[model samples]
Target: MILDILMTFGSARKNEDDCQFNGYLEDYLQLLDNREEHLQVLFQKVVEKYPNARICVGLRFAINKEVVSNQIIGYKDAFKLEGKALIRSL
Candidate 1:
């Protein structure tokens, strides 16, 4: 959905003169930040069920509380994840 929205704007005739679309993208990112707490809770639950499984969380570091690093699968920089609520075996 987001990619479609972005792509549509990129192809617009006045795309080079547009800033509204960029603002929309920032709003979308802000909404993601608002859900960070809820996502962190879900992440904890999954870690509990699979203690031995490798997991990685994603974040923008400087953008504190902006979003949970919820990309546990198919993520490359797993070690760069700095914060953790828990990592011990169950």
Candidate 2:
């Protein structure tokens, strides 16, 4: 599993082409944010598509402490655990 995770990370490459397309660094930043959102939605879709296979979407979103707590431990999607519940909850 560590290898799988590492292999995924190893494949990441810089998207300098973003700067070329947007003509500014801010545009590149927006590209990164859009990419992040795409990844988030993709993970959610994957969980919906395959409920049996083990997977997780570990992401941190900025918000109030209450909201953080709710997403991090109060809901099933908190840790985005691979199964029906957070591993700790089980």
Candidate 3:
């Protein structure tokens, strides 16, 4: 099963006209920064509802008409830390 969470900051017409690409980029980055927390919550909820299923987290972003996407099946075993530490190390 595929689940998607879509977030829109402003009207497409206005965003296209005003070239609000930077603002949208900022918002997307913020979302990415909080992705781990979001993923953890989603994993816990999904496991509760579908006990035997596997989980994967996908991330996507569009900026100035360019799109980028990636998926993570599971985290690395060596990465014992999270949040700011993980971000700072990278």
The lDDT per prediction is 0.38, 0.36, 0.34
Q: Over the stretch 1-90, how does candidate 2's per-residue lDDT look in tens digits?
A: 663542232111234211123122233233446548765565456556654433222211223335455435655344444332321111
Q: What global local distance difference test value does model 2 have?
A: 0.36
Best by TM-score: 3
Per-candidate TM equals 0.22, 0.21, 0.23
lDDT of 1 by residue, 16-81 (tens): 422222333223333345548675566456556755333211211222343546564434354456
Model 1 TM-score relative to the real fold: 0.22
Question: Which parts of model 2 have CA positions greater than 4 angstroms off?
Answer: 1-35, 56-90
Give the number of the best model, judged by lDDT. Answer: 1
Model 1 misplaced stretches (Cα beyond 4 Å): 1-35, 56-90
User: With candidate 1 superimposed using the best TM-score fit, by how many Å does residue 39's alpha carbon deviate from the native?
Assistant: 1.8
Please give the range of 10 consecutive residues that has the lowest summed lDDT in model 3: 81-90
* Error in Å for residue 9 of model 1: 34
Q: lDDT tens digits, residues 8-34, model 3?
A: 323233433212222222233334445
Model 2 worst lDDT run, 10 consecutive residues:
16-25
